[model samples]
Target: MNLENKYYINNSDLKITLEELKDKGIIYIENIQRGFSKYPNLIIEGSEEYVNNAVKQLVAANGIENSYADFYYGRLDEDEKNKVKEALNEREIVIVESLQLSKDDIFVHLNDELLEILLKLTSKEVLFSTFYFTKYPTLVWGNYGRRYPVFFKDEFVMETVKEQIWV
Candidate 1:
């Protein structure tokens, strides 16, 4: 999808987010758009080697089985994909999203360090498919009776009251 003119995030905000993520043991590099387009997509790039190292570090930190990294490149060839898959197979937990990558798409394991880092960067908790709702939700479910008005009318108070009343 063309991300032009879309409000994915501001540069400063993204920097802050990345800083926080790094503090939580995640590393990322910013890929600024070089062309003339006014609205450019901010791409987060990292090498497979770097990601592997991060996964190992995370496994050690969390004291749990290795997990997978949440991010992936949408345009990787077969050789690159296999290399990534091999690395992921050696881990314990895998976090991946279905994207058009190569002929054979494989899953990888991830550790808590990477997961926590991703959560911080995205400002949202993430989890496996089994815990999808608890991790992310497209819609919120709630119970409301007729006594609780779904549609209501309220009076608008535009004037500011300066007097302070003591009870």
Candidate 2:
């Protein structure tokens, strides 16, 4: 892992739908054809160690950092997939239309096809997963999700999500 890369933890309430549900089922896209890129940042040596220590300090503060965060999907059996699927279907959209997209904005397309992609995320080191559907605020998931943001539909799966962070 590149320690120099920035890491953050969010503690604010999110109002967006799933695609980030602080926003909804999102693809975090840009105009790929235009070669839009992420903002450059200072990469100090040994930053990961520093960030880890800082993260530890943050965790020491109650309700500041959610050290124990997990999604509600684990609670549902077959219904888990269905819940996500239903959210996608209801938030159905295609970006082909004449939607004016900002250069810095992430372009997300929600639909039934997203169900399969959402289930394939398994990397423990993943920056973001479908866990955004859980009860915690969007900031909790963005702790790592910001690096590689993924979103799902809004409201469609709020019933299965917890609004607070765990532990």
Candidate 3:
């Protein structure tokens, strides 16, 4: 079997199910993020008759659409949207807990947890883009001219923001 990176297909040419992929030679199966993604893709890694499997490719999903902001969130199905909402709603930090507040409280820097959330939104392209960090407090967005609202510390952040995601 000289096949490389080909899916574990049966004699009927239909790709084997996830359950079968493991039993018969297939070692890895996952959706890989490609370019400016729009949806899912299944890539099957090298395999043998249960013992000859070679770890050729490490499969991973895009996780969430973030770089293009305002749009990627909408592109996600209901389940992904819910997960994102949950992440944003988590409140384990205060401006004092992880962020430094300005003299008058008008401006606050990014919290570690929030910064992590923003980083994950960006596309994991071959060459990672630095916009995720450069555009401090705004999060990742593809729109060149759209003015993103500044995130304030004393607002109903988790409750109102997550709810407004649809609006």
Candidate 1 lDDT, 6-116, residue by residue in tens? 323222111122233334432222221221132211221244343324323434433333222334333455575454555442221232222332332222233343444
What is the C-alpha lDDT profile of model 2 across 1-167, one tens digit per residue?
Answer: 32122222121221122344333322232332221242211111223344333223323332222222222333344554354434442222121111222332222222222222232222222222332222222212223322323222233322222222112
Q: How many residue pairs clash in each candidate?
A: 11, 25, 0
Compute the lDDT of residue 89 as modeled in candidate 2: 29
lDDT of predicted model 3: 0.25
Per-candidate local distance difference test: 0.26, 0.27, 0.25
* Per-residue accuracy of model 3 over 1-167 as CA lDDT, tens digit each: 32222322121121123344233222121222221142222122222211111110000011111111111332445676565555443342121123222222221123333334333332221111122111111122211122122221123432332344312
Name the lDDT of candidate 2: 0.27
Per-residue lDDT value at 9 in model 1: 23
CA displacement after TM-score superposition, residue 10 of candidate 3 (Å): 54
Task: Give candidate 3's error at residue 84 in angstroms.
Answer: 1.6
Residue-level lDDT for 31 in candidate 1: 21
1 or 3: which has the higher lDDT?
A: 1
Q: lDDT (0-100) at residue 133 of candidate 3?
A: 17
Give RMSD (Å) of candidate 2 vs. truth: 18.1
Candidate that would win on lDDT: 2
Clashing pairs in 3: none
